[model samples]
Target: MFSNTPISANHFLIKQLPQATAFIDKNFKVVFVSDKWVEEFNLSTRDIINEHIQDLVGISSKQWENNILRCFKGKRTENFQENYTSIDRETRWLKWNILPWYNENESVIGAIVQAEDITAQISKEQKLEQVQFILKETNEIGKIGHWKYNQSQDIFSSCPMINNLLEIEEDSKLTLDEYIEFYKIGYNRNTLSMAIFSAMENKQSWNEKLEVLTAKGNQRWVNVSGKPLYCNGKYIGIIGIVQDITDYVIKEHQTKSNEHLLKTLINNIPLHIYIKDTQSKKLLANRSELDHCGISNEADIIGKDDFDIYDKELAQKYRDEDLEVMISQTPMINKELSQENSDGTTNYFLSSKIPLKGPNGETTGLVGITMDISDIKQKEKDLRNLIKVSSEQNKKLLNFAHIISHNLRSHSANFSMLLEFLIEEKEEAERQKIFGMLTDSSNNLMETLHTLNDIVTINSESTTNKKEVYLNKQVHKTLKHLNPLLEENNATVITAIPLGTSLQVIPSYLDNMLIQIISNSIKYKKPNVRPEIKLSLSYVQNYTVLSIEDNGIGLDMKKYGEKLFGMYKTFHEHNDAKGLGLYIVKNQIEAMNGKINAQSQVNVGTTINLYFNEEN
Candidate 1:
């Protein structure tokens, strides 16, 4: 009954506490032990309760007792980190929190000791510290920097790499302004300023390449990226990383300079230079093309295709030619092409196109050079025409020689026969008539010689002599020169000319050509109607077209078309119609590398079209 009392029950219940609790007497003996202590040590509570403290725990007896005695001497201590070897000989770290206890009279009795296992936490912290040291060392070796700016404090903090990158001492302090001042001139400062402003005002991030002057007075290129930090929609500051890229920057600049030098060399040449994209039909043309096409501004023609600036047929022809060059993967030289402009002007070109190959030896696009050859083409045409004219003249001269020889032989024969007849018959009238026939035949031979001399003179003049002549003024002058004849024929002349229509031609030949046409129009006036002649001139394509139409007794072209321009062959019986006018007109036009064609009907009218090449 005494053991089962409430006091004993209370003592048993107190002994069942979850923690390791114990009561030690003045002799340092364990007087009471909780169930937790017994279970943790694998000892019976009754057995440990009566054991001495030094014997219960298997640590060094002196060190263990000293720690317990020190706690009981009115001293309090907590978390004295220590290591203990477990039963398995594995070392474990522990923290001991020991507190001294006392009675109400403040006399020290014993202590409460709490031990916490801290091995895992301590090992984790050690590994993390090692990793951080490695990262710092790597940043220093790589010359990379991490930086942060605090707007609230208006301060900047940088890692060791930043100090090394700027060639500043390790202990040096740097501000944002000082950092900005390190940037080299031009884009560096501007880019940095823009980036900072954007982050501050617009909350934008930026990545840029910049040039900076280090403290050692050397210029360096760096790639920098800055991002703004925000907390609760409030702007904090910016953090950024910078990498040294000076070698890459220098290489890139050199490459760009080389490209520009190549482009300049290409542009300086006389050829029309152009570049095309491989996948797209985009083109970049040089200055030569702009000038050749009469374009004043580069923007006006940039990014435009051939169809945008040239005639439809001509553009299609250009595309087809380019496509062939691209597909064949062959370089073409001196390829002849004709291009018509938006104004209907045609240009002859000798072009060369070379495929632009890529690193894989595949055709990427094409580079082309075109040389204007209108002059060359015209010269070739003139040479051919000269050959034709020479052959025709040679034929005519041979025919004239035969006719002269035959005439001379016939005349001598006839003279001999006449003399024999005169001597035999002795008729005075018949002899005199025979002599007169002989004289007439001699005069005809003399006239043929004079005509031949004139033909030679006409053929001897040079064709290429050119001089600037105003068309309107030349027309007026020609009309004035033929005013008397025009007035005599009762002709009404009408003229329609736009201003500033000037041309490059041989002035004398042009005047002669105009005079002949105008005079012929008047000379062939109809019987009943007063001759009305209209003269007009305008530019068409690259050539100037001059038209002369007359209300006259026109010819039946079907009957005499082939002989219209035959030398010394007259169509009309007019005294001035030596047939040489049209012949000379045709020759002069041909010599000047121009063209002339006539349209006529029996009773309607005649119109002659003259086309002249434009001057460069």
Candidate 2:
């Protein structure tokens, strides 16, 4: 230090600097240190002056030592930033400058070393670098970019991410007009233009989602956000960020379209479909379901429980079923539900319900589908009735066969016996008696044959071979033929049949039936009471009904109702009662696909109704 007296004088000046600095002599020993240098390095209790520079601050690098050695040869050396560690093992950043000091003879005497502690500044720079790295990574991964607009200069600048998104060259400078051209032509361009204008005029901030046409002629969706830049009450420019949102936009559009399609499909289906949440609240209902409930719009039913729409008891039943299905997480498929209406009719439904589950397989709600099966149920009932009727007809036909065989055998035996007797007679009187008996037997056989023939004809008649017969004309014709019998019995016939009242039937069969019915009214009249018969026509559901009321010897219905229409069944003991008229009439009516029922009281009257199918 004595070799450079001038340097010694300036050492005090060097120590007065505000920076944490140090001065060293050519021998690599620290000669002076500033107050800030002691505080910065935590060397207040240590005497570093005159200490070897390497001892105080370890400079282990060879290049750093060479630079310090060069200062002794009248050369200057500097390092703006270098790493260092103090003797206490404290790491720091330093700015170093080493220069030669001259004596009075203008020759190099020793070196001066100056150093500044730059650890805090270096730390701030490192932190800033790390932030920039993170931001760049985020922008690339998100397909996003930042942009700036200079309004006065009409300049637009964007980051590298924007260039990649647009599929254009990197670092391209664009004019305001050129920048806007990247937006799509119709809605996107117009919107961006207005946004820019508003931002420039009113200094407003805006964010918009818009479409862009890339340089490669591809379409993309993007979201742009902008904030007006202001400086000291003066509007200057705009800063904004843009993000590529093509994937998100496409997915959103597809989702909406699918929702619309599903809604349309469910609405058009004939079955009633509905969705309910765990709370049994209606979440969705299709058109059929809405129609069933007499609702015009599905929105009116949303978030409403069954209790809000249906009868209290019915709603409770539905809710209970729904809860059971959801709680069990099971599906009820093709379950037949029958409801008894107030009118004593039962309505049927084919219903299905499935549990709706969450992502973790927990029950969330249920979806139900129901179809009205009342028509099908009615058809089943009709089929069962037809089967029963067919079975009964089969049984009656069997009985008829047995009756025919028995009657034919009896007639044949009587004929053989009478002929045998006639051949063995030896007297004329006996021959005459045999002849009379033969005649009577022949007549009886003929009558039985005719009756059998009639039965066979009625059963074998073709149901399709039917013609429209006016009831009034037919009744009149039958009465005209029976006028003699009617006069003898003093029987009166009254008719209230309409002129055009008609029934589809076999004409010959209908004529025979009318004759039999009118004759019975006359023959079975009470011994002292003149017979009175009334004929009328009326219409009932799906049937044209003809009713005949007779004031005659009526039988007790409770005793004979079941056998009234049976073959060879007779309630009266008249000599003319062959027990076949009502049976034949019933068969003929059935052959025409009509029905007959009778109501009667002993010694009072009888009313017989014939139902003819209107459709037939």
Candidate 3:
């Protein structure tokens, strides 16, 4: 203790001190102070000597005061840190040290006090605490954790977050092998093992998405990354991070599955489905559309427009329609259209198109579907033709009914007159004559009945199955039957029908028809000229035409063309003309789904052409 020491010596010693320091007497008055003390307290050029410690520090605390008193009793006291107000009235932290000074007799004389301004250090520590807190919260929220592996010691260390992510207790410490067990078996485990090994051996870094099983047996996806650690160019350990990515991975998988399902549905649909961009270029096409466009691969049709696959005019039309739909933001539903093919056949389609919109409701493109309706069109046409045929048949039935009524009435009138004459006769000869007339009338009525029966039979049996018949053979058979008539008319018959000229027809009908027509040609021959008849065969489209031409007294076609094939219609006056031969022929031909027409010139010739369906 410098009780006898010069104050100047004490000042010299304290001034040499490199820390904020002060020396005080037992009465708690400062004896000398260091330059550091002045600088730390922000003091101007003024003396602070002989000042009480409380006055210099400007803080009133019983504990601080008691510590100073204890220092005077030869006890040393130290405060690591203390909060106090400075001379400027700003709050600050300080570290204090107090010790009793010793005299030559080893008795305590005064205390030496030292203080350190630690405000900056305290502020730094507080900032560090705040950063640590933020980091912990971030880890919990992001499902992230960090880990390190010490290669030399074979030790693996991880943060508490890792345990939480693995669904294990916070205090659980797992060995290297045990930690690996958390990775899902098979590919996930193998991948992590390989990545770690490679990182250590090659000093590389790796990042991978892998599956893991938690301690509670829950499946999860995780992103794992590792980098080899080095210290002084020597491999020390591996440091890495792991993040829970289950939600993200699952959402991605679901999106992929939905896309696949949509693609399959579109491709399997029967309609031709296609998608186009705002520029009217192909963006997507289903399998049905690819097949329709004769494309084997989907990629081949990408970016193509209608002009690439269709005629110029049709392509332009299609593009125009697409533009209209997109611009109007409207849907064209089930529009019927016809397309003519290169083969000169027409196909029908039912097409629909709708504009596609973006998220902001702007028109982005268009989607279209076209269905082939060619089969449906054919069915409609067949239905119309059937209705027309039914109407024509009804008209024919009405005409037949009128013809039957008129013919039956005539027969009945004749019978009545003959019976009256027989009843009024007075002599036997007269009675016999009336009876003969009655018999003749009865015969004529019976013949008319037979004719009616023939007509009825032809109509009823129209749908009978037909057999193949050769035209030349049938014509010869008919001529042989009509040889006597031909001889009477001195007719020269020429059979121009080719051999093997076959037709599917009712054999009996053809035979009867040939007899009626050829006989008429012979009966109506020019009075002075010999009759000449020619039978020829030809084809027109799906019909096989058989022409029977005759050089005889032809009828006036212009005058009687309307009733050429009408029942009970005769163009010329003749006793043998029953006005039934051509009508019967026409009915027979039609029953076999054939047609009949005549070209004639008076006194020149008549050609009766029969058209049979070659397809049948």
Candidate 4:
């Protein structure tokens, strides 16, 4: 059916061939190329006729060229597949079938080669390999095992990995009943049984996650899936796969538990907690923060910003601070902040803000907590006020003692001079007059000593043995004792002290001080004016202040106001004007942790104010 001529001589006939065919000589030179080869592989017969195959194909793998060599030496067909990147940078595939050609001398001269475009085929084959690899890897990673249960024999055929998945002995195949026992009874076993029955009766497939217990008494979670197998319209068996999911299940449960705990702690605590999105400007505020913002529902506040709830200025300020937090990406700790409330009041807080980070350590947003500090700030203010009052008391106490010493020295000098005069006199009448002068001087010295001792006693007692003392009753007792003196001066004491007036103070000191101050008004009355005193008690700024007004010869306050309470500094001309009375009054009030102030005008009147601290 063929000619005995060399295949190289039939080049003219090869041009009419339908398949892509090329003939190469023993020396690997191209002998012929069919018209189909030129059209299919894009080759030129004239250009490649006498050229070496290496020069035309431009193939670099010398070892891969062995197919051509084998065909050149033998009268046989060689099949090969080749892939390479083309000029357009796409991968091209070719399947080559090379057959040796013979000459009339019965010797192989060249080979006829046929090439087919197989790019799509090779691409599909590669994809299949990749899918297989993925499936195998998934099964291994998930610790999956496959099984088939034959209903006829009530037996299960399991993969090698099933023993590991179920924690059973190696190489041991279990019966269907034994495998069912591995499922934790109650819910887990019942579910599996129902699923199996559903698959058999309703032709349904099941994919469920459930718990299991092994022979070794270890519990685990498993992902199970099965499909029922049927033959001749009758249920035959079931086939399925299983995966151990204990670690994944446990981890998921723990994560949810931790989230619940954090939610409880955040909502229940007193601090205002919040989280904010850096870009969207959305806020997630906890329960305490919601209450602070006067919002009742979480849904109402979610996805909202400060602008939604606060005034424009406050919202802008809040956003600017958020920007600062994002830029710094560090903790902003213990910054004092004040926020205005809906009721026109302001609340203070010690706020701390910190940035939230992503998995790659990039700043994502910010979280903050604010502790209310208004009460602490109020306490601090009260402490400062108390310190100021204590300092003023110490300064006046020093000045008060110095004035008392001066008065003592003046009285002692007068006593020494009078005594010396009495001792030197010799005449009987003169001696008698000197004795009377000595007696007056001794009484004055004794009075000075008693006043000085009272001042010392006032300074020594710091804390009072506090008790409720009735003010009106004490005033009554003093007035009764001074009735004789009041009668001699034709004085009237009009008291506005509430009938049930009461205070917390030392009883004896309050009684003595009240007597001295009340009598002083009577003693210092103007020469022509009747002795009139009005005493009243009322509350002023948490203090019970007693006011004693008298139509007395008041001194010029512009001249003596500064030393009005100075010991031995007398403003009025009176036989009993020692001026120690008011000084001693100041000390007694200080001992009770109270205050006294006197207001006077030129011979008009006097008002003595005694301030007793109370829950007025």
Question: What clash pairs does model 4 have?
Answer: none
Estimate the TM-score for candidate 3: 0.60
Give residue 164's error in model 4 in angstroms.
4.9
Every candidate's lDDT: 0.76, 0.84, 0.87, 0.80
lDDT (Cα, tens digit) per residue for candidate 4, span 1-616: 1244445366578878877777777777776777887776556544877788666665555534677677667846457788855434557787878776766676777777777778999989999999978877887888888888877877788886677778887789898778878899999999988888887678789999999997788899999999987789778889878998999999989988989998999999989898888862546788988887889887788788889878999889878888888888878899998877768977889988889989988888899888998878888889889789877876776776676567677767877886787788788898888778778878877887887787888867765575798888888898999999888898889999878888888777788788888789888888867899899887888789999889898878889988888777897667878777888888888778788998988778889999887632
Which candidate order results from sorting by lDDT in descending order?
Answer: 3, 2, 4, 1
Clashes in each model (backbone N, CA, C under 3 Å)?
Answer: 0, 0, 2, 0
Most lDDT-accurate candidate: 3
- Runs of candidate 2 with Cα error greater than 4 angstroms are 1-34, 47-116, 158-168, 171-173, 225-240, 297-303, 331-334, 341-345, 352-366, 375-504, 512-591, 595-615
lDDT at 231, model 2: 76
**Model 1: per-residue lDDT, tens digit, 1-616?**
3254233455676478766666665576665666766665556633665467656755443444566778889876544666766544667665656566565677776665555567888888888998988887766665568788888899988777777888999778889888888888678898998898898888889999888999999888888889998789878999888887878789989999999998897767777887765632547778887787667676776666667767788678777777778889888888897876668978899988788888998878888789999888899999999999889768867855675576567766877786777677677788788778778767766765675565555556665577788888999899899999988888888888778877778787799899988888887878878899998886778778899999888888999887787666788777655556787787677567677888899878898888897753
At residue 581, what lDDT does model 4 achieve?
A: 82
lDDT of 3 by residue, 1-616 (tens): 4455665656677797988988788888877788898887876466688788777768687877788789888887867578888878899888888777776777887877788888999999999999988888887788889999999999998888889888999888888678888998899999999999999889899999999899999998999999999889988989989988888899999989999998888999888999999988899999989988889999999999999999899999999999999999999999999988889999889999999999999999999999988998899999999989998998989988998888899989988988887778799988888888888888988998999999998988854578898888888888888888889778898887777888899999899889988888887888899889898888898899988899888888889888999998887878988899999999998888889999999989899999998666
lDDT by residue (1-616, candidate 2, tens digit) is: 3555565677677777787666666677776778777787777887898888676656677866887678678787766578887777778888876667666886775665566878999999999999998888888778889889988877789888787878899978777788789999998999998998898888889999999899999998999988898779777799879999899999999999999998889999889999999998989999999987779988998999889987899889888889889999989899899877768988799989999999999998999999989998899999999999999888888889888888888888888998998899999999999889888888988999999998888888988889988888889888999999999888889999978888888888888778877787777778899899999988988888888889988879899999998877887777877789989989898888888899988888888888877576
After TM-score superposition, what is the CA distance of residue 101 in candidate 3 from its true location, in Å?
Answer: 22
Give Cα distance to truth, residue 53, candidate 4, Å. Answer: 9.1
Number of the candidate with higher TM-score, 1 or 4: 4
Q: Candidate 4: deviation at residue 97, Å?
A: 8.5
Ten-residue region with minimum lDDT total, candidate 4: 1-10
- The TM-score measured for candidate 1 stands at 0.35
